[model samples]
Target: MEKKELVMNCTLALHGCRTSYDRSDLDSWYLLGTYEYDGSKLYLNTLDDKICYCDRYDATPLKSWDSLSAMLTSEIERIFGLFDADGHCIDEDVPTTPVVI
Candidate 1:
């Protein structure tokens, strides 16, 4: 649950919500958090675990849903590693300890 002071003033249209599937129940959806994406400005919102939200953020109308989704997809692609023609991830090595990139 989110703290009262960190209440999210974000809307679903402009903010992308990240969800998770419980290890025990794959069919169920649980919210992880919200991401406020404004083009180059993307930040983890202070939203609590819920599937829906109001249409306004801080008394301002949120951006289109398309913008939020597009940003989320782009960010995921950048973070997720690429795969090879053989259908395996290009980088297969596992790190035993922390190493700075």
Candidate 2:
């Protein structure tokens, strides 16, 4: 018989609901929950199958958990080329257009 080994990664929480990540292949995981603070939202994912979801808008609200993590992932994808509420750009900073007086 052969045995398989499991690998686990950890993420650290940042100020407010944000987090500091040290992930290499971020595409492998799925979102599990979210926390709202100020005007920003933080989505959390787990390496394990267990989830800690808490919200009324969940698709399977009463089911406690579901595989619909792809939904949040998709939302993150949709905003890939935009700026946050703050003035930070999605990509690296670029020179702004100057105004002519």
Candidate 3:
């Protein structure tokens, strides 16, 4: 949980949205945090876990929806290493030994 929180916080600090997954019994959902942006300057909650945000040009107001689809797609790309195909780790044969200090 701590690790997850840290990741969320860091992401929010960087991108204004720290998108993350919320695993529950029935289903999973995307978690989004609050933010305030001034054109390009963005100010968001460092404790939130969201990745995407949108502001419309309507007079009523804007809504906040969990970007589950986008977050999942991004996660899939990360897990499969498709984003950086050449950066995958390689497992090579190596000798191991034990010594007494």
Among these predicted structures, which one has the highest TM-score? 1
| Segments in model 2 whose C-alpha atoms lie over 4 Å from true places | 1-31, 37-69, 81-101
Over 36-96, each residue of candidate 2 has an lDDT whose tens digit, in order, gives: 3112222333454333333324432222223346433433443332334443444544211
Per-prediction tally of clashes: 0, 0, 6
Candidate 1 per-residue lDDT, tens place, 1-101, comes to: 33211222221123344354334433232232343332122232223222221121331223222343554454344323333443334554632111113
Error of 1 at 46 (Å): 5.7
Measured with C-alpha atoms, the lDDT of residue 5 in candidate 2 is: 10
The candidate with the higher TM-score, 1 or 3, is 1
Candidate lDDT values, in order: 0.31, 0.31, 0.30
Rank ordering of all candidates by lDDT, starting from the highest: 2, 1, 3
lDDT of 1 at 46: 27
Better of 2 and 3 by TM-score: 2
Between candidates 1 and 2, which one is better according to TM-score? 1
Q: In angstroms, how far off is 81's CA in candidate 3?
A: 11
lDDT for model 2 comes to 0.31
TM-score of every model versus the real structure: 0.23, 0.21, 0.20
lDDT of 3 at 100: 11
| Candidate 3 ranges with C-alpha deviation above 4 Å | 13-32, 35-52, 55-67, 72-101
> On a 0 to 100 scale, what is the lDDT of residue 101 in model 2?
26
